[model samples]
Target: MKQEQFLSVVDRDEAERRFRAALEPLGPLGVEEVALAGALGRVLAEDIASPVDVPGFDRSNMDGFAVRAEDTYGASEQAPRRLRCLPEPVVMGVLPVGEVTEGTAMAIPTGGVVPRGADAVVMVEHTRLDGDHVLVEKPVTPGRAITWAGTDIAQGEVVLRAFDVLSSRETGVLAAMGVDRVGVVRRPRVAILSTGDEIIRPGTPPLPGRIYDSNQVILADAVREAGGEPVPCGITPDAPEAVRAALLDALAVADLVLLSGGTSKGPGDLNVQVLAEVLAPPGILAHGVALKPGKPLCLAASGRKGVVVLPGFPTSAIFTFHEFVAPVLRILAGRARPARLHGGEADGARTWARLPVSLGSDGGRTEYVLVRLTEDAEGAAIAYPIGKGSGSVTTWSHADGYFVIPREVERVEAGERVEILPVAGVRPRRVDLVIIGSHCVGLDVVLARLAQRGVSSKLIAVGSEGGLAAVRRGECDAAGVHLYDARTDSYNTPFLEGGLVLVPGYGRLQGVVFRAGDARFEGREAAEAVRAAAQTPGVVMINRNRGSGTRALVELLLEGTRPAGYAVEASSHHAIGAAVAQGRADFGVAIDIVARERGLGFLPVREERFDLVVAASRVERPGVRALIDELASEEVRAALRGRGLLA
Candidate 1:
């Protein structure tokens, strides 16, 4: 891979342009004729015209007696005009063989053909039937109860326009209009290929840095979402010869090809080289975007076929798929790709509160940080970041939606509030992850694992003191802390003091957590709020409530340092982090673990033994035991890494 020719890296806009330009040369799949029944979900390829009126002759619209309006003039319940009953009857789907001569009535049901000389039909319900006779109870009007010809659909009218989707209702319309066949647009077929020596098939054991391929599956999903059929051309080890052969073969059967991985100028530059070779003089439309995660992108095409290559990173690849492929998919399917996910309701949740959580984003690109969202006490939206790293696959599984940070902004200062567009289909109320002490870096790993098992858990990283308070108040499922119980010479015992039972779990080192880069500089030991928004109107303070171990520790450090009536509360470590991020109140108290993942400024409060407290009544519950078991697993220790309260 000759050091991958030096090409200037462009940004997101350039990347999209290159990609779209590559795909533009291929023509859309035109209309194909098929049986009406088979075109149920396909797009209409041509207009359909009805040759005859929906009903060629006047017909009965209801089941009633038919009569001339003139014969019933002034005839009402007050004074009825009874007509001699003519010996005639009509049924649905059939034309009358004889006519009711002038001044005579005929019995006809709904949809029956109108008889000669019959001008109107009265409801059978509205009239009484006597032996060989019928009495009209209401006034009869001319043309009443009779459906005129061409009422539903007129002759020579276009029933379906070209490019319209053939819904069941649309299909029924054609059937009613006497159409036995339909013309539909052909479904675009896409060949999905995964290329790379480092990519492994799903379920295969990984070797060192090698990883199971998820890009292809995600890309295929993108293809399907775009209204194209995914042929799943499968994985091929990266070799220029192999890449060229596979691409050539895919082009023979596919309208387009989606290749995941190898868009970057890594050791596997074979994709770039081979695509350029196969695509002709103007091949390799573009390579290398300026976006943070997906910068290593590639686009290439010839007159007959096109190829879109995405970087190996899962999140980047997914984003790129939506960026480049989704539009084409819609065009080929002859429908617009929906901008919003299904099952979403118009959210009235405009008010949001800053909870104790940090934000991360790659520099130079608008990074989309995935988060778990929940509502606060007042039903305000609150978001917490999912652990992030381009390589962290867990972020994808745990996130409900993503928060976008604009380019070159490297950091989302803790407490700086932002909106999140949630992934559709999320039920925020079903979350179960609740941790009471300092937020941790890898807690998101636990969330992802839980999600993998089909569980939705909300991570509540409240501080050690907040944990105890929450546990006492029944605000959460579990609490973690490393509180020094001087009387017991142990961690967390005195915090439990009485009512709650401690569930045995492994121990973690707990302390102040700060941004990865701020590892060395410990900021001011105390925290304060710049302004108060909701709990009070004008005043704000980094105050603590009665139950927090962090507050107790803070009180021990500076006697009565908390301002009078300044007892403005921070609900958890995350809430405290928010206070700090927004400069709301002078430093409040918290452990270090929760602050580390956000790249925030953190001051170590103290080391505490993090523990989970089960309500006395809940101690024996199976779910409680399960919590304890999971806490004891190796995964928990991984979760505890860099969390504020760990000692």
Candidate 2:
């Protein structure tokens, strides 16, 4: 058989688009009617509007006399009012026989229907039974203690929208809406097939050079978590005929099919070839992806069925399933995207977090970095990078989450954040403080102090301008900014907009950072060193992103001459240092603390005031207050001064 191969390894975005396009024709799974008691986790196929009011009739919410509210008006213990009594009180299982007229009252119990001419119910405790009348002591207002018709739920109101996953709570809602059986999307059936000859079931004894199948169990549970039904198609040896037979069986009973192993280009690997030849037209959509662990991923579709060829290695299989298969399964199952929890209390509910250490990756390919999350001594959640080989299954069990490094980024600096999709069932701390803006070493110190107070902050390094824009749009609680206004010769305060209060932060020593012992900076002053470096041949200059205060100063120092590698932009000051330290560039602009940490020599250019700008209204909020107090505290100052970056 002719082996099928990838046309080109596409990036994550293009891969997603192709998968989505292929699955678009599958549409929603066929609808099925499920009893309310068994509807948990099922997605609704139709809007469930209430057919009738929940109570269905006007009823009493309290055991008291039902009378005109005006009769009890101004009635008090000191000056009691009396009303004529009815022959009998309102009874359960029977409506009131007669209405209470002026100066008349009737006894009513909880859940009893209210009679006509009565607008309120005065509790029995507030009234005393007399020979032929009841004496009221407390005042009662109209509609007091009375639950009117349709109070619980209104008729024709859409209680549940289509495609809503039915939680236990939602099932209760359906019950309340008088829906006994509901139409819901059928659980997507996922067929799993292992196609390697060296694989055996878990119960079987291991043989030399052979392993038990773990992908089936792992992938099956993953499908269940995403609201799909997994059907194990059993294992097939590495043969074209066997693989093809298993796939056809899977396609017969499954909405989606996953064939593990046999995807790589080898004589024994025939899953890709089978998918291309045996599957319906538009056979193989993608044969490979630019994904790190799951680079050998293969995708195909036949009519309404989608098939994915997964790598045999457990770690790679899991990663590929999560990154590629889970999302499409959710679409077929009609699961809505989970909402992000807001507020500090839900801080442990976010899917991703800030990277505490720098992570390096090759550009142009999406890399999934495995990570383990641990709370530091201060109770702040920290994600430590794990770089075990993709073939090692232990990496999956050890990882709390994994972060996807984009194709455009080569390195993520310490304190430069990333989103971490947790392992199937892991929950992370909620981001207590959201700071979107310029990255600074001094701010990192302040964050460390906050961590000591058990507060977690998420920092996004998007330059000073982006931070300010985020603050303006109310996207974040605060932003770290150090924008230098050339006109005013001042920093952050000059560029402050309305609704934002500039909190004065410590000044940082901005300078040129270069590799140690570089001859260009041996004795030259800061400005001269920069000019010399720019004019020298083979000298590469790394720079911070435009709109950064440090970048502004670098431009000021450059005057007009452009340097080699000027087009290369680093996300943060630490990134600049890391770039130069790694020999990716000759020199770059950054702060002193970061330069020293990377063992790079620094030449002081000027002190830039790095301020924290917050929404004026959030000044008293807990996280913002902690940030303000920590920044002004002596501990933060001492830590900052120790690094020689504090002013």
Candidate 3:
């Protein structure tokens, strides 16, 4: 079988233009009458006007006596004025029977209809009852303590406009207008299908060569989040007949069809082929896009109904769905588009942020880098790239937003400003503490403790040297460092300069890590194991990134011998342990905590001091003070000790 190639590869803007042109003049599907009880989260289909005036009639706002204003105009505590009191008392929800004439008053409850000839209401506390007459001690003005008819809501006034989303507040307004039902736009029905021979249901046991179908679950919820109803069509195999029947069924029952997988340029990729045969006029607007993580996307339409084929990769599928499909879904469901910040129209759904490190792009494709947002000491936003590729499933969940690199640009220099677009449904918030430095598992316990005390923190792992540089620039409140000084033979104190304070943190046992049963490293000393691994042929040893204290230690242990896989540098201790545990490398250096966590064998080298370096100007910050206080607490010390750190 021959692989089917893309009909055309176009830029993102051109692809979006072609797709929208194919499905022009999009609007809501239709309208339906829904009870007010079930109207939450629904968009109004038509303008709603009040049926009757709110409050319906003039009413008293407090429990008081209704009387003519002249009767109480000159009344005072020293010289009380007397008035004749009516026999009947006014009750709530009922109209008063008698009128209040000159020098006359009647008892009225709150919310009771005001009687004719009454111009004001006097509080019961200010008046005294004497037989059938009332003595007024306080002065009153006309229309005082009274709510006039139609004052809250006037009749024939539009209360809600079309396309307004109904919340609790909106529903309350409709209820006050005596409306039992409302006309709301119908939710668009979307059908989701997953295709692949390697796809299996989530609850089933894992097989040797199969993966669970996560795209279906992700797309189903995403459709609902975009205000569309999802109709799930179960997974289909690679067989042509099975996929064709599934596509036809989905098209017949859904207003839009989404098929993930089988859109790339592989012989087994046949969803696009099947879609081309079924779509009507103006079919297959664009087959491939010039964007990273979403280049294999295919867009098509059957008259007004849209059919999209998403890439099989989770990140690619989700990115394309939001960039292309979500906007159309919002229009069909009568939902408003998201608002962009002022002066950002050219960037389109993006805001400005500072990138801390340099990044390289593919040059041929527009790359979107997912980032986690944090703040500097001066409260400016910084975007740290996640660095995980498109195949990673956890990137979407962990990312705060993403920034794009254009196809023409190949590299973004450090400290360069870039425009970031927020992830759907994620609102970035300012954190209380910003810690930039090496990653540690024990730090998680400390941050968790801070969270219990209502402090939010953001940690960026950029190595010890980078963190020290950031501290000098006042880019962070504090930085965690574990730099070893060869001259002074100290861990962190020797590295501190003027205006920088050293906060004693904890010690971690750095060691050589390997698989538990690997005979080459299990029971040997740290230096001996490292030397043996470096000398042995085909014994791969993973190294840490430059500027890290662990990398310095690795260089010392290697003694100038570059072993296999020495160039493969990882960013964190966990990544080093993962490489050795997964057989990607024979040995690596990490902390004892990581080895214990990953169930790997450890040979201790030396205990390294991990301490905090604080900027002198930011030492008095509330978050920094709180962090210092927590570090001195016995609870934190105990927790750190439990996690294999010497606190």
lDDT against the true structure, each candidate = 0.60, 0.76, 0.81
Candidate 2: tens digits of C-alpha lDDT, residues 501-616: 98888888888888889988855689989888789876778767677888788888888878766755655665566557656467878777767665788898888898989988
Model 1 over residues 351-432: C-alpha lDDT tens digits?
3435344655568998776676654334455566654333322345455566678997887765577776655544334343
- RMSD vs true structure, all candidates: 29.2, 27.0, 32.4
Error (Å) of candidate 2 at residue 14 is 2.9
Given candidate 3, what's the lDDT at residue 189?
A: 95
Judge candidate 2 against the unseen true structure and give its global Cα lDDT, from 0 to 1. Answer: 0.76
* Superposition TM-score, candidate 3 onto the true structure: 0.52
Worst 10 residues of 2 by lDDT: 337-346
Ten-residue segment with the worst summed lDDT in candidate 3? 338-347
Better of 1 and 2 by lDDT: 2
Each prediction's TM-score against the native? 0.49, 0.52, 0.52
